[model samples]
Target: MTRIPHEMSGEPNPLRALTLDRLRSRTSMKWRAYPEDVLPLWVAEMDVPLAEPIVRSLTDALELGDTGYPAGTGYAEALAGFAEKRWGWEVAVERTAIVPDVMLGVVEMLKLVTGPGDPVVVNSPVYPPFYMFVEHMDREVVEAPLGADLRIDFDALDETFRRATTGGRRAAFLLCSPHNPTGTVHTADELAAVAALADRHGVRVVADEIHAPVTAGGVDFVPYLRLPGAENGLSLMSASKAWNLAGLKAALAIAGPAAAADLDRMPEEVSHGPSHLGIIAHSAALRYGTDWLDALLAGLDDNRRLLVDLLAEHLPVITHRPGEATYLAWLDCRALGLGDDPADVFLRRGRVALSSGIPFGTGGAGHVRLNLATSPELLTEGVRRMAAALD
Candidate 1:
């Protein structure tokens, strides 16, 4: 494998804030899932400290006893500002509504666009929740597996879109930009092709862009709504993933120009789920957290290169296709000869926890997803444990 030179941003490593001792003391799912001796690298939660701006905002809100119900468009406006500044995308703040989080917002948008039992399209080896929540909503899922190159298979997507919209059913496509597990950032041309295909099939698109801000390694994240033929699509976004504010629970659902009326059809109850404190925290993140985010990105760049070197030296049999974005690394463990579910063996023998790939549906066997958003010391130890497990 060719080595890519590491890029430095000269900022302090924000990830250094969380030492292994500090992380183990927390009670989050990632830390609580395994025994004390096991190293947890399964979940998407970043092992980093909160951005100072977000901390300050939440503290100020609590000091004034301002824990009333969420109101107004603070979250939407903040997102609009961030979008324009970062992606050069013009977001219609007035056309956006606050929802509890990205998943709930996607479900609500799916309800607005497609009926029960209607077909929904997704790329396989996707985020696990894409399968769970869509089934819970009584929707039929059509899989368009990513190509051998680990990017969206346009040919497969075309075929799946046709099957999904068969008989003129009101189908919806759930798009994960800066895709999880693989971390493939979809390009503008690819998004435009998706727009054209959706237009042809008369299907509505709901993009889960929660990972937009964390795109690293010289890749640019293009918002789906910014495409030429994407005026009818809807986007679900939040600062939760990038800013490590998932527990706060705030997200936005923005509509394209032609879909503004459809957003109005969203039930009033949907807007009530977002927390007022969450809005303040998320708003502050978009408004003032860019420097911290940049520093985190620089640190993540270092981690990515470090993992490449570690795998080459310690676990040469396992191949990692470095993703253009996100901290997750998809490991092809087929060569390890550990059978289909290697994560189970690693957990028991290596005392290291990781996400099993089979749960991601078709084409997931013989793979594992490893989270790299930890201190360098912990990351080094985790890889060492996996190597020892093989021995």
Candidate 2:
């Protein structure tokens, strides 16, 4: 696990220097979803190269012909190391289990905490899959819309929790730390309050902290389980989001002290869903990819700031209040008068694709989630096209 020194790293800008032509040549969903003419800024995927450690680990696995079912606690140990080093959080390897991906892990955790037809609380304008997967499990969704500042509205959350558990039915709260589509990272105070409310209402909190390592600038991402009264919570984490290893498909489900019993009850077959190669890649990432992650985070910080300037210079009417985490930018498009779905208009007129906000549930209409995890040139061009669409 040799770490690369910052001065020795040769790339002038690891993420910003990429050209559109180079990116368009690839066949990923972001590139293939639209015509060559359109700039794809809709998906959460980054346009950067894979981390060296992950590449090396995957190549080694392939060369050795060692691709089989995943085994051992190496992935969990690597995660524990990363958590201790990065967040000062200690993970008990025994209480953690591997899953195919973060969303699937959440689904399983919800099943363990609540029965089918039970209520699950979530914040509105959240990750689209939160709504989709909860409904897919025959569970009801309870929305607690984020406040105007794009942070958690504790009052709304308490009310939603009360409503969800009114029937003496236990509910599960699916929390998205450093919330998606808005990039709002929850503060320690905010998370502690959430724990208090959930504790009072006898609700189980399952935190999706997949974006924990990618937090930008100086924002402190509070892992939900670390707060007081959070001993009953479950957290889903992955190296995929930060290291651009989504295709590898590995994630971890961790349980707090009180919730360890619930995690222990999860079916053994659920662990079989993880890919062996995916585990290897993710383990390598946590153990050896910190430098690469640091560089990527630096680039993301720049892109977020660059977006503010781009929006001001090009699409003045579109207001972007930059959040402290994630490469996603939530743009307020109400002033543009693009009807209920601005993404549709942008795709047809501007040749620029953005994630439609409508699917993120209430408070999402008149908005679009733009992916800023690409090169500066491509990001600038996307904004330029979006501006031209207005004409």
Candidate 3:
């Protein structure tokens, strides 16, 4: 049966516009890691409260409160169901294993598949972790700087992989889907190109898909496992970013027969150490989050447009692509004349906290990533501050 797409009902809900209220209503505002007084348009966490359904599920679980080790597909089942429902993809329930977070999955995969000194090709100006994970493992990290449009430099990718393979650095690429900081959603063809390259070089693809579920607009995010050579490589998936449950420390590593045995390389003790509560929260989030996700994605579209309009009217020199994923706006702030790091200037002068661009590595120096998962009032206020600082 063919299903018709559904849209949210009746103008926007006012309840949805309450991040500023939440911020103001807090009586005992401690010094937030995100900083106080200055509105945080920085962290990836949405400023909104948890989806009611998720809150209920977690509340119910806490009421039961076993706080013991989680077992069976009891936890991952929600995640598996979500995959089938949302993406039309089926993951073998048994093959999936829990990890504390997506980065751990990447690190573990890097440790398992490559030697100590192997090279990992990361697309530059990419997620900072893409560089850090390889470096932490003492791996040779090669940079594939992004192109003018901020999409992967397929040409640079070709060169990096070729050199890594030829020089016998034994290359493996960390592929970021619906890439972070820049928010470019890689199309199936784009992902296919990546997979083809990895396959040709016999490089494993440790695809970090933490932000896969929150793509903006007409952009479609193809999971690396859904790409051509996915079975030949490894893919990581998590609900942390999509559901704002990063505190839960729940993520999964999805592998096919090609990379199945690699999980064996991790010590038995650490595999067992992931929190039961985190796993339960993960299950609840994945199972009950569809409606909330739909609402949130809709909210993000509004937020993205607001930023574009505000930037156009107030900060005209700044250029931005409508965030195609992850609700983060990548702004070209170099035109505004603050030398080197501009996010710092936005914070110091604008009184608005935003992600610094340089930490995203190569080709990202002149940009600052704006996080838009907040109430319109705060977002508007943030823009006002930015404009004042610049002017």
Candidate 4:
């Protein structure tokens, strides 16, 4: 029951401040999915305490027996405030709808713009769920694999969009902003190019901006809706990733001016999927969790740099390009000769669990994603175990 110090009181690095013993005590998927012998760094969950404001808000709500169906526009308003302050982007609250979570929100947004069996394009080696949920909904997933540098491949994308929307058929482009696995934060120009292409091909853009707030090293995150050509685009956002509130399932589906009508068509029953408490917690984090988030970003930056040193020193064969956003590191293990799924080798031989890259679709092979949101000690140990697998 050790309390984490407030970031304002000068706790420099939250990642280093936490201990493995404390992290292992939690029952979250990141820890419980594997045995104690294996260091669990596979999932998106971070090893950090709840921001004090979020805890206090939820506690106060419970003490008052305030648990009921979500109401009002508090969550949307809070998000708007946070977006304006952090990214200098203004969110139109009237055009936002709350849904269960980012993935579910993406599904709902897709449904708004597409139909069953219609094509949905994604940048491959992206988030696995983007492929799963879209396919589960009976939509076709067209892969426009990223370029060698892991940024958008415009030529491929333009051609894919043409193929997807043939015969005047409608398609949706599922964009992962500040993308997952690789953590490439799309620049303003890149996003603008995507908007232009989506418009030209008559494809609706549905951006999964769940990782927006986690950008590090002074990178600017441009919301898709903020661009001029993105007037028809929709974006799904949540405080879950940045604030580690994944258990509390709530997210906002924001629509650009031209797409407001489509967003409004979302079934009203879909609103019930989000927990009232989740709304409160997410809202509190958006409104009052800025200081804690800043500290977390700083700590993640530290780990990002530390991972570079650790990989170079211990596992020189793995190629890691540190992304400007997200606490996940995409490691290229092709040189290790561990076959397509290196995570399997690492887990079976080295007893350390990491995410296998196969499920992430095209360009995922010979790669493994390591969660770097934990203490430096655990990260170092994880790399050491990964190296041991090669031996």
Superposed on all Cα atoms, the candidates' RMSDs to the truth, in angstroms, are 3.1, 2.3, 2.6, 3.6
Can you list the residue pairs that collide in candidate 3? 216-324
Error of 1 at 201 (Å): 1.2
lDDT of each prediction vs. the true structure?
0.90, 0.89, 0.76, 0.91
What is the lDDT for 166 in model 2?
Answer: 94
lDDT of 3: 0.76
Write one digit per residue (lDDT tens) for candidate 1, span 1-391.
Answer: 1212224334467778877888899999999989999999999899999988999999999999999999999888899888887888888888999999999999999998999999989888999999999999999888899998889999999888888877887899999898888989999999999999999989899999999988775677899999999999999999998898889999999999999988999999889999999999999999988878888888888888889999999999898887788889999999999998999989999999999999897878999999999888888999999999988
When sorted by lDDT, best at the front, the candidate numbers are 4, 1, 2, 3
lDDT of 3 by residue, 1-391 (tens): 1111224433342226565646655433211654567777776767666666667877877788767776777666777777766666777767677777889888877787789888888877887877777788899888888788888888889988898888655678988777887788888788888888888888888888889888765556666786656676777787788777877777787786677787656666555756777777777778766667777777788888888889889998998888688878888888888876888888888888888888888778888888788777778888999888876
lDDT of 2 at 374: 90
* Candidate 4 residue lDDT tens string, 272-344: 9999999999999999988888889878888899999999999987899999898899999999888999999
TM-score of 2: 0.96
Runs in model 3 deviating more than 4 A are 1-21, 24-31
TM-score of each: 0.97, 0.96, 0.93, 0.97
Model 3, 151: alpha-carbon shift in Å? 1.3
